[model samples]
Target chain A: MIDRTMTPLLEVRNLQTHFFTDQGIIRAVNGISYDLHEGETLGIVGESGCGKSISAFSILRLIPNPPGKIVNGEVIFEGTDLLQLSDREMCAVRGNKIAMIFQEPMTSLNPVLTIGHQVMEPMVLHQKIGKKQAIQESIQLLSKVQLSEPEARMNSFPHQLSGGMRQRVMIAMGMSCKPKLIIADEPTTALDVTIQAQLLELMKGLTRDIGTALILITHNLGIVARYADRVLVMYAGRIVEKATAKKLYSSPSHPYTIGLLASVPRLDQDLKKSLSPIEGQPPDLLNLPKGCAFHPRCRYRIPKCFTQSPELEQISDNHEKACWVDVH
Target chain B: MKSFIINRIAYALLILFFVTILVFSLARLLPGDPIQAAAMFNADLSNQEIVSELRARYGLDKPIYIQYVIWLKDFIQGDWGTSLGSGEDVLEMFFRRLPITLELFAGSVFWSLIIGLPLGVISAVKRNSWLDAILTTTSIFGVSIPVFWEGIILIYLFAVIFPILPPSGYVPFAESPIDNILSVILPTFVMGTHGAGLFARYVRSSLLEVLGQDYIRTARAKGLREKSILLVHAAKPAMIPVVTIIGLAWGYVVSGSFLVEYMFAIPGLGRMGVDAVFARDFPVIQATLVMVTVNILLVNLAVDLLYGYLDPRVRVRGNLGQ
Candidate 1:
C-alpha cells in the first residue's frame, strides 16, 4: 500500500540515456520520468530491447561510459540529487542506501571468491565492520535467504551453488546493508519456474518485512501481476502506460498495453481461443518510426497517431496513457 | 589436491621419458665423430689403432641401442661422463654453473614481473590514454629489439661510456653479493626485455577481457573501490592465462639464453651448452637437453597446479576426478 501524502523515496526526472556507437546514437532511455514511493514494489515491463533495464541502470549511474552515457537526468534519492554527488559520496550511498541484484546469478557472483566473502563484503565495506562480525552477520543472512548449511555454504565457491541457491546468495548480499531500495533486474529470469515463484515470494516477503522499496524489472507480465503494486509499461524507451496493478489489468487504455495483456494466456480465458500477439517488431532505437514508435503495431491508430507523437497524459485518477485515439 | 599433484607428476615423468630418448638420439646424430673430435684435441692420438682404442674406451663402437642403454644407466647413476673440451665431469660442471644460471633466471623473472605487470594493469585501466600509448610503445620496443644488440648497447652505455659496471665478468655471490648483483644486472635486463613486453601484452588483453565480465559489474555495484574491483575481483581470473605464458617464458629462460650469457661472460648453463655444441661434446649436450626438458616439465606441472588454485571450477573438476 502506498501513502500519496509523503514525498516519494526516489524521483527520476526526464532521464535520457544514450549509446554512441559507430552505427548510430541509440536513444536507450529517452526522456523517461517516474516516481517510486517508499515501501512500494514498482514493476517495469518491456521487451528485451526496450529501456526497462537501462532506466534502472541510469537511476544508479551504472551505465558504462564511452558508448553508454546518461546525457540528461536528475535522480533524486532521499532529498539528494544523486547525479550531482561526487564519486566518493555516491559510492557511500550506493550499497548503504541502494543495492542492486543483477540478472545472471551465475555470472554475477565472482567465481574465485567464496560465497561467504562475497556476501560479507558489502557489510565490511559500507558498514565498516570487523571481519568476525561481518562473517557472523553473513551466516545469518544466508540462513534468512533459506539456504541450507549456511555455515559451510559461506566457504563454497559460486560454481558449487545451484542457480536458485546463487540468486538467494545475491538476495542476501542485496539485503546485507538493509538499503532503502533494491533494484532487481530480472532476478529470477534465469531460474526454473518453480524456483522463480519461490524466489519472488521470498523477495516480496523480505522487502515487506524490512520496508525496502523494490523496482522489479522484468519482461514477464505474470511476475508483475503477482508482485508489483504499481506498473510502468515501457515501449521503445518511453513509458507508454502507468497505472496501479488492478487498474492497468482491468482497463489498459494504450493499444500496446492492451496488445501485451491479450498476448498472455489467462487461466480464465477460453481454452480454445489462441492468444492475439502484438504484430510487427519493436522499432529500432537507432532509427525509430516517426510519430508513435508503436504506431506500426498499434491496432487503434488514428491519422493523428501517424504524424504527432503522443505524450503521457492523465486519463483518470491514478491512471495515465500515451495515446492519441482513446479506446472507450 | 594430493591426487591431482600425483597425476601431474606421473604425466611429467612420461614426458621426461620421451625427452630422454629424443635427446639421446639427437646427440648421436650430429655430423662429427666424437673420437675424431677427441683426437683433434689430443695430437698424440693420431693413429687409427689409438682412435679405435679411444672409441672402445668410450663405448662409441657399440651398437646404438646398447650404447643408449649404457648411457641411460650411467646417467641414472649420476655419472654424467667427462666433458671432451674441459675434461671435467659434466655433472660437476653443471652443478658449478647451476647457481649462476638460477640467479640470472630469477632476476630476469623478477624484473619482467615488476616492469610488465603494473604497466599492463595501468594500460588496461587507462585504456586509450597517453600513458597507455607510451607503455604500449615501450613494450613494442622491448619485444622487437634484438637481444644481442640490446646487450651490446647496454654494455656500451654502462660499461664503456660511463664505466660504471664491469664490462664482462662473473663474481661469485659468496665473495661479494653487491658486486654479484651489479655484474648480472645488464644481462638479466637483456634477457627479461622480451618477457616484459610479452607479459604486458598478455596481462593487458587478459585483464581487459576480465574487466568486461559480469562479475566485475557486480563488484562495482557492491560499491567496492575501483582499485579493489580491478586488483582483487578481476586480477585472479585474468592471471590464469598469464600464468601459462610465464611458465613457458620461465622454461625458455632456464634452458639458457645463450646469446645473453655469452655476451655478458656469465658462466651459466647456456654458455656451457653453447660451448658443448662447438666442441661436439656429446655428453654435455645430452645432459643440458635432458636437464632443460626436466625443468620445462616441472614448470608445466607447477603451472597446471597454479591454474587449478586460481580457478575454482578447475579445482572442483580436479577434485571430482579423485
Candidate 2:
C-alpha cells in the first residue's frame, strides 16, 4: 500500500548455502536469488526440505554452525549486505529491523517464563525501556493480537495457553518492534486447518496495517495464493518459477509449478477429476542429478533435459521459468 | 501447590519410618552381639553376668518387636538411650558434634555451588573448546580420586608442604572463626571437589540439552544478549535436573564425609557414627542413622519445591483451567 514504485527493500544475490556432513556436502540452497519491494508479501512455496526455510535462515544468519554455512551470498537489506555486517551489527538488525516467527508455537516459547516477560523481552533489550513500561506495552501488544484478558493472560505460562493463543502471542512478539521485515516460517503449519486460515488472515492484516514486508515460507500453495503479492516456486533448492501471484497461478510456465497447481484439489474445478500427485521423491541434495535436478521426475523430459541444466530465463514481462519447453 | 507439598511431606514421613526399621534391623544384622562387644573391654566380668546385665539394661531379653516399640516410644519422648562405650546420652553426644557437621556441610555445598555452576555454564557454552576440554578432565579427576587420598594430598600441600595450616583436628567456629576454617579447609576441599565435580558434569549435560531447545533459538531471535539467554532462558530449566542431583548429594554432604572427617579428626557426625559402629554403640548408631535419613528427606522435599519454582509447568499441569 505504500511506495510500491521505489527500489527493492531486500535483494538476495546468488545465495549458496551448504551443509557439510560426514557423508558429503549437501547443497541446500544452491545459487538462489530473489528481491522484495517495500511492503511486499513474498511467498516461498516448496515441498519439505526444498530449502525454503534454510534460505530464510540464511538471510538472518540463523543457520547452525559447523554443519551448515552460507558459503556465498549477498543478502542486501536496505542498501547494506547483511552478510557483510558484523554479528553485533546483525544483532541490531535482528528482532529490531527484521523479525522472524517460527512454525511450532507450542515449542517456540520458553516454558518457564510468563507471557508478559517474554513479550517484553525484545523491548527491554533493543529499546532500552524499563521493565514497567515494557510490561504495559506488552499488555497492549497482547490486546492487539486479540488475546482475551491481556492483563491476566500476561501472567500465565505458555503451557496454560491454547495452541492458537500461543501462536497469537508469537505474532504479537514479532510485531512488537514494528520491524521493516518479518519472516514467517510456516507460521500456521502446526495449527488446525480452521485456525490456520484465521492465523494467516491475522498475519496478513497486521503486516498490511504496519506496512511491514513479509517473507512467508510455506508448502501450502493455497496460503500463498490467498496472501502473497509475488510467488517463488522452489524445487530441489532452486527457484524454477517466479511471477505475480495471479500470473503464476493462471499461466504457470514451469513443469514443477504446473504439477504443484494440479496436485491441489479445487472446489471450483470438476469434482470427478482426481488430483494428480507428482511422482518421485525430491532428489537428495548430496547426489542431486547430472544436469537438471527436476528432469528425472519431469514427464515432458527430452534427451537434452538430462545432459543440460536450464537457467531461469524471461519468457514474459515480469515472469520467468527455467524450462526449455514452451508449455504455454 | 499446597497439595503437592503436603503429599511430599507425607511421603517423607513414610520414608523416615522405613529408615528407622532398616537401621534397627541393620544393627542386629551386624556380626557379634552388642553385649559381647561391650564385654570384651570388661574381661573381669563373667560372660553370663555381662550378657544378663546388658540384656536387662537394653531390654534385649524382650522380643525384637517389643524392643523396637520401646525404642520408638523413647525416641519420640526425647529419652534417647545412653551409649554402651562412653555411657553418655547418645542424643547429647550427637547434638554436641552436630554443629560441626552442619557447618562442614554448609561450607562444602556453598563452595561447590560457587565453583561448579559457573564452570558448568562455561563448559556448555564453549563446548568443544580447549576450556571445555580442560574443565572436563578436571571434573573426571575430581570424581575418580578417593576422598581419603584427596584429603591426604591436600593436607600434604597446605598442612605439610606449605606448613601454613594444621593437618588434623577441628576447631569450633565459636572459638575462633578463622582457625576453625583453616583446620577444616582441607576436608572441605575434599568434599567440595567431589560435589562440584558431580554437579559440573550434570549441569553441563543439562545445559547442553537446554541450549539446543527451540526456546533458546527464540530467545536469540528476540535479540536477547548472550548472557541473558544463557542465564534466564537456558539456565532455569537446565537447573531442574542439577537441583535434583544437588538435592540428592545433600544427604551425602550432611550425613558427613566419613573419610574426610576421620582423616582430619573432625568431631563430625560421620566420625562419631563410624566410632559408634566399631564400639557397638547401638543408641548412637540408631540416632545417627535417623538423623541422616531425616536430612535426606528434607533435602529431597526442598528439591521438589525448587522444581516447581523453576518450571511452572509442574505446578500448573493439573490446574490448567485456573
Candidate 3:
C-alpha cells in the first residue's frame, strides 16, 4: 500500500503534448496531470486514441519531433523537473531511474539480438557494470520473472520465445536496473486472457516486492480494478476523473467513467441485463468540439455541457471529475 | 543445416542442367556457321574437299542433337572443345584468363563494400539533410552512368590527363602484386562505382525501414547510445536485403565484365566470351554461359546462407522447416 499522505514520487503538471502537422495542430496529451505515490500502481484508463500512450511517451520525453512535441509540461520525478533535464541528463535518468515496457512484446525486442544482451544493456549503460557481471545479473533477473532455463534462454533470440515468455523477458529487462518507476503501456494487451492474468500477476508481485512505483496504462477497466491503487480516467487527451481505485469503482463521478463501467459485462451483475457500450466514436484531436469534447456522446449531457468545457473540480476528498451536468 | 545445404546444392544442380540446354540452344541461334567462320580465317583453303575435311575435323557436319550430346559428354569429362578462332582448348583458354576476371571481381566487390556501406549509413541516418541529399545525388549519377563510360572517363582522367595509372590491361597477381593492384585499380573503380551506388540505395532504404522498427525504439528507450543502436542492433538485420543486392550484383559484374574488360584490354573471361561470340566459337560461348549461370546460383546460395547467419530467427525457423 502507498502512503499518499507523504509527498508523491512523481507529479505531472499541466502537460500539453501536441503534433504540429501540415493539416492541423493535433492536441495529443492536452493538459493532463496526475500524482503517483511511492510504491503504488496508477492506472491510466481510456479508450483507444485517447492519448493514453502519448501521455506516457511525453513523460519520458520520447515523443518524436517535427510532427509531435511536448509543447508545455512539467514531468517532475524525484524532485527534478524531467522536462527541464538536458539530453545527457535525461539519458542518464531514462533507464536508470525510470524504465518502460510496451504493449507488443512480439515486436518490442530486437530480433537479431540475444535476450541476455538486451536484458544486460541497461545495466551496462546506466550502472556502468562489466559485461560478464551484467550477464550474470540478467540471468538472475530472467529467473526472477519466472522464466525457466534462464541461462540458456539468455542466448536465445526474441523470436524463439513464446508471447508470454517474451513479455516476461520485457518485464525482466524493465526491472533490470531496479528503476523507481515503470510505465507499462498496455503490457498485457497482446497476451491472451490466461497469459495476461499470469503476466500481470508476475509484474505486480515483482513491483510490490521491489517497492517500485508503476503507472499501468491500459484500456481494460477490469485490470485497473484488480491492480491499481489510484485511477486516472482520460477522455480526449485530458484527465476527466481522478480518485482512489476503491472510491472510483464505488462511485464513478464522470459520465464517461460511468459509461466505461457499464460497458463491461460484470459476472456479479443481473443475468438479464445487457452491457451498454458508449455510443459515439472518439473525437478527432485536430478538430475537437467547441466546448466539451465528450458532450456530443455524453448520455447525461445538459445544455451547459454543450456550451462550456468542464474543468476537474473536487466533489469529495481525493476525488475529482469534470462534468457540467448535475447528477444526484 | 547439413540437409539444407544439400538441398540447395541439389536444386542448383537441376538449374545448372536446364541452363546448359538453354545456352547450348541459344548459342547456335546466331546467324553464322562455325565451319564457314573457321574457313574465313584460312581463305587459301577454298577447295570444297578441304572445307569438308575441316568440317569433319570439327564435327560440324553432325546433327544439332548429336553435337549437343557430344558437347555434354566432353563437358562432363572436363574436355572443352577447341576454339574456332584460336584452335586453343576452350577450358585451357578460360582457365588462363580466369585469374584476371577473379581479381577484377574481388577488387570491385571489396571497393563497393568499403565505399557503399558507410555512405549508406550516413545517408539513412541523416535522411533529408544536406549530407543525405549529396550522397543520394552522387549515387544517382553512379547508377545512371554505364560502366564502360565510367571506365572511359577514368582513362581520360587518370591516363590521358593525369598520367597517374595505366588506363587498361591486367597484371597477374602472382607476378608483382603491387603492380597488379595499380593496374587493376582504375577498372575496379569504374566497375565498383556503379555497384557502390546500387548498394548505397539498397542499404539506405533497408536501414531506414529497420530503424523505424519498434525494436529500434526499444533500443533508444534502453538509453543505449545512438551509435551503438544503429551499428549493433539495426545494422545486421538491415544488411539482409543489402546482402541480396550484393549477391545479384556479383553475378551481373561477372557477366557484364565483357565491356569492362574490352575497354581496359584485360585478358579476362568477359573479353574471351565476347571474342567467342563474335568468332562463332560455339564451345567457348556455351562454356562461359554455364560458368556465369553457375556463378549466379552460387552467389545467391551464399546470400541465403548469410541471411540465415545474420538473423537467427530465420535460421531457427528454417531448421524447423517452418
Candidate 4:
C-alpha cells in the first residue's frame, strides 16, 4: 500500500561499502539503491555475509573505519543527504531521526549502567529534557515494550535481565526518542522462536502505531512474509530481487530468490520432501567471481551470467530482478 | 553482601594464621642465632652458660611448636616482646615508623594513579597515533627500569643537579609539610613509576577491549557524545581489571619497597625490616612480617568488596551465596 507519488521517507542511492584489509579490498556492500515510504516495513533478506547488515549500516554510516568504509552512497533521509552532514550534524540525525536495534541484545546494552539511564539517555540528548521527565518517559517506554515492573526494572543492570528482556530494553531504547525511522538488524535472531515472534509482533505493532518506518534485516523469509510490506533479497553484496512481500512470496523472479524459497522448509509442503539448499559458498569479497557475484551459485545461470553482471531491471510494477536468465 | 564479607574475613584469618607460622619458622631457620649475635655484642655473653640462659629466657630452648604457641599467645595479648638487637619494644618501633611508610605508600599510589590513568585512557583513545606510540614506549621504560636505579637517577637529576628536592631523608609531615613532601618526592616517584607503567598498560588494553564491545556501538548509535561514551559508558567497565591491579600494587607498596626505602635512607618499616633481617632481630622481623601480611590481606579484602561494588554480576552472585 505504498503511495508511489508521495515523497519517500528514506532513499538510498548507489550505496557502496568496502573494507580495506591487509589481504585485499572487500567490497562489502556494492552499489545498491532502494526507497522506503513513510510508515513502511521493508525487510532485507540474505544469508550471512550477503551485506544485508552492511547495507543497513551504510544507510546510518555506522561502518567501522580503518577496515570498513562507505565509499559511495547517498543516504537521503527525510530529503537530506546524511553522508554529507558534519559529525556534529550527523549526531543529531542518529537516534533522533533514525535509530537502530543491534543483533545481539545481551551485549548491546551497557553492562554497568542501569536500564533507566540507558533508555533515558537518547531522550535527554535529543529532546533536551530534564532527567526527571526522561525517567518517567523511560518507564513508559519500558512498559510499552511489554517489560514487567518497568519502574523497579529501571534500576537493574543489563546482566540481571534475560536475553528476551534485554531485547525488550533495546526496543524501549530504540523507541525512546520517537524516531522517524528504525533499522532493526536481525533484532530477534538471538531469541527463542516464541520470543522472536512476540518481539517482532510487538515491534511491528509499535512502529505501525507510531507511524514510524522500519527496515528489518533478517535471513528468515517467513519473518519477512509475516511482518514486512516490501522485501529486498540480497545475495553476495547486491540486491538480486526486490518486490512487495506478497508478490515476492507468490512469484519470486530471480533464481537466487527462488533458490532461497526452496531452501526454507515450508510447513504446508509434504514433510517427506527434503529442502534443496543453494549450492557453493558465498564468494570471497576480496576476489569475487568476475560477473554477477551470485552467478557461480545460481542454478539458472546462463553463459551471459558468467561473463557480465546484471543490473537491477524492472519487470513489472513494484518488482525488480538482477539476473540474466528469466526464471518464470 | 554480608555473607561475602564474612566469607572473605574467614579466609583472611586462615591466611594470617599460616603467615604467622611461616614467619616464625623462617626467622628461626635463618643462619645466625639471635642469642649468639647478641652474645657477640656483649662480651659477658661469651660464657656458654650465659648464652644458654639467654636462649632459655627468650623461650628459644623450647620445642618449635611450643615456642610458636608462646609467641602467638604473647602476640595476641598485645605483647610483641623486645627486639633482640635494639632491646626496644617491637610494637613501639613499629608504631613509630608506621606513619612514614604509610605516607610513602600513599604518595606513590596517588602519583601513579594520576600519571597512569589519563595516559592509558589517552593512549587507548588515540590508538595507532603518534601520541599512543610515545606513551606506550614511555610506559615500557617505566616498567623495565629498576626501582633503585630510578631512585638514584631521580636523585642525581633533581637533588644533585637541579637541587630542587632533597636527595634522601624523612621529615615528619607535622614538622613541615613542604620539607616532608620534598623529602619523599624522589622515593615516591621511583616507586610509582613502575606501578604507573603497569596501570597504563592495563588500562589501555582494558579500555581498548571495552571500546570494541557491542555496547559501545550501541552508545554511538544512541547519539551520545564521544566523550560521554568513553568516560561514562566505557570507563567503568574498563576500570574493573585496573582496580584489581591497583589493589595488588597497593598491597606491594604498603608492604614496603625495601630497596627504595634503603636507597632513600627513609626511617620506614621497609628499612627497619631490612635492618632487622641483617641483625637477625627476631621480634622486629616477626612484628614487621605480621604487619605486612595483615596490610596485604586487608587490601585484598577491600579489593573484593570493591569488585562487588563495581560489577553487579559479582554483587548478585554474592547475594545468591555463590
Predicted candidate 4 versus true structure: per-residue lDDT over A83-152, tens digit per residue: 9998888888889889999999989999889999999999999999999999999999999999999999
Model 3: DockQ score: 0.70
lDDT (Cα atoms) of all candidates against the true structure: 0.91, 0.88, 0.88, 0.90
Model 4, DockQ value? 0.76
Q: Return the TM-score for each candidate structure.
A: 0.98, 0.97, 0.96, 0.98
Worst 10 residues of 3 chain B by lDDT: B313-322
> What lDDT tens digits, residue by residue, belong to model 2 across residues B108-222?
8877888888888889989989999999988878778888787888888888889998999998889998999888777777888877888889989999999999988888787
| Candidate 1 vs 2: which has more TM-score | 1
Using TM-score as the measure, what is the rank order of every candidate, best first?
Answer: 1, 4, 2, 3
Q: How many backbone clashes are present in model 4?
A: 0
The order of the candidates by DockQ, greatest first, is 1, 4, 2, 3
List runs of model 4 lying over 4 Å from the truth: B254-256, B319-322
Report, for all candidates in order, the number of backbone clashes: 0, 0, 0, 0
Identify the candidate with maximal DockQ: 1
| DockQ per model, Cα | 0.80, 0.74, 0.70, 0.76
Write candidate 1's Cα lDDT for B203-289 as tens digits. 999999999999888888888889889878998999998999888887886454778888888889998998898888999999999
The RMSD of every model to the true structure, in order and in angstroms, is 1.5, 2.1, 1.9, 1.6
